[model samples]
Target: MKYFALLFALFFINFKQKTDKLIGRYSYLIEDNNSYIQKDKITFKDSVFVFDNKYMPKGKISYGNAILLENFINTSLVITIPKNQIEKDTIEFYMHDKNSSSANYLDEVTGKGRLIKIK
Candidate 1:
């Protein structure tokens, strides 16, 4: 019984650690200005992040991208963009929700939309 309890606790801890790996890929929409509208996609693959900003129907229009860095502190994911990429668009990392199976990504540049995981 004692060993079974220990094993159960360890299993839960390991599961949480695995879930934390999805941190940066999750995002949502936050509009300080109600001037624009639309949705977007934020994805993680091959150690790179793709931010598709084809949501907004106006303005110059652009796409955002970023690279993921291993989190040094806490279980959160750390994200950064290259200088060239930053010159064209803005990007950032968002933390994942504990209760969510998947998370939504916020556009750090336009701050207009979110990237939801496809089922």
Candidate 2:
């Protein structure tokens, strides 16, 4: 029994480390009013797809081969980016809405930001 518990602990630790390798500290530059604004540091948790932001509740993020999607729990809406849409230094975000349309970040919650890898 003791051996089994030790094995389980080891497995869990390894699992966390592997997933944490993919997740770490990152920042998003929010585009607003013809200006690029910086949001803040967001810490991503592995396995569960959660991001930490002090201004709001926990945010859930989904990742694909090239794009990372985020959904807020309080409003509970899905935001995503298609894999093919990534450019040299910018990522586009599509708004979650009834109508299918490109999201405009001038005055909208779902805004696209040019992501720079800072980790």
Candidate 3:
């Protein structure tokens, strides 16, 4: 039992290191914003996801976790990005609405969101 426990502990540590490992700073952009903005920064450090828009009123910080899934990354209540959509410096969020695929995040006015990493 001791040997089994030790082996299992080691395996868990290794797996945790590999999973939830996206660390960097990314910024979200809305439509017509076309280009990247330094404000509204979203940072991911060791699986911790944080969003801070300097322009927003104080005490309005948005935070979550960098949940790395096999095919998607869920960082928001109703949004998730396909693993492949995450590029060298860009992360694209697509909306999956109900009545179509039992999905969420879709609407008439908005369909997708983009995040550009901060160098």
Which of the numbered candidates is closest to the native, going by highest lDDT?
2
RMSD of 2: 8.4
lDDT of 1 at 1: 100
Decoy 1 TM-score against native: 0.31
Q: Pairing residues by index, what is the TM-score of model 2?
A: 0.46
Residues 23-55 of candidate 3: C-alpha lDDT, one tens digit per residue: 677776644456534436766655345567544
Model 2 lDDT tens row, 1-119: 99999999999998775221235555566678878777665554652344445555666565565344445554635555565543233445554542335453322445555444454
Which rank order by TM-score, best down to worst? 2, 3, 1
* Clash pairs (backbone) in predicted model 1: 27-104, 27-105, 27-106, 28-105, 28-106
Q: Which 10 residues in a row give candidate 2 its minimum summed lDDT?
A: 98-107
Go through the candidates in order and give the C-alpha RMSD of each one to the true structure.
Answer: 15.2, 8.4, 8.5
The list of candidate 2 runs beyond 4 A from truth reads: 1-22, 47-52, 63-68, 73-77, 84-92, 97-110
State TM-scores per candidate.
0.31, 0.46, 0.45
Between candidates 1 and 3, name the one with more favorable lDDT: 3
Q: Write model 1 residue lDDT over 1-119, tens digit each, in one string.
A: 99999999999998775221222343434344653233354555533444455542221111235333332223333333332432222333233322334453323332232233443
The TM-score measured for candidate 3 stands at 0.45
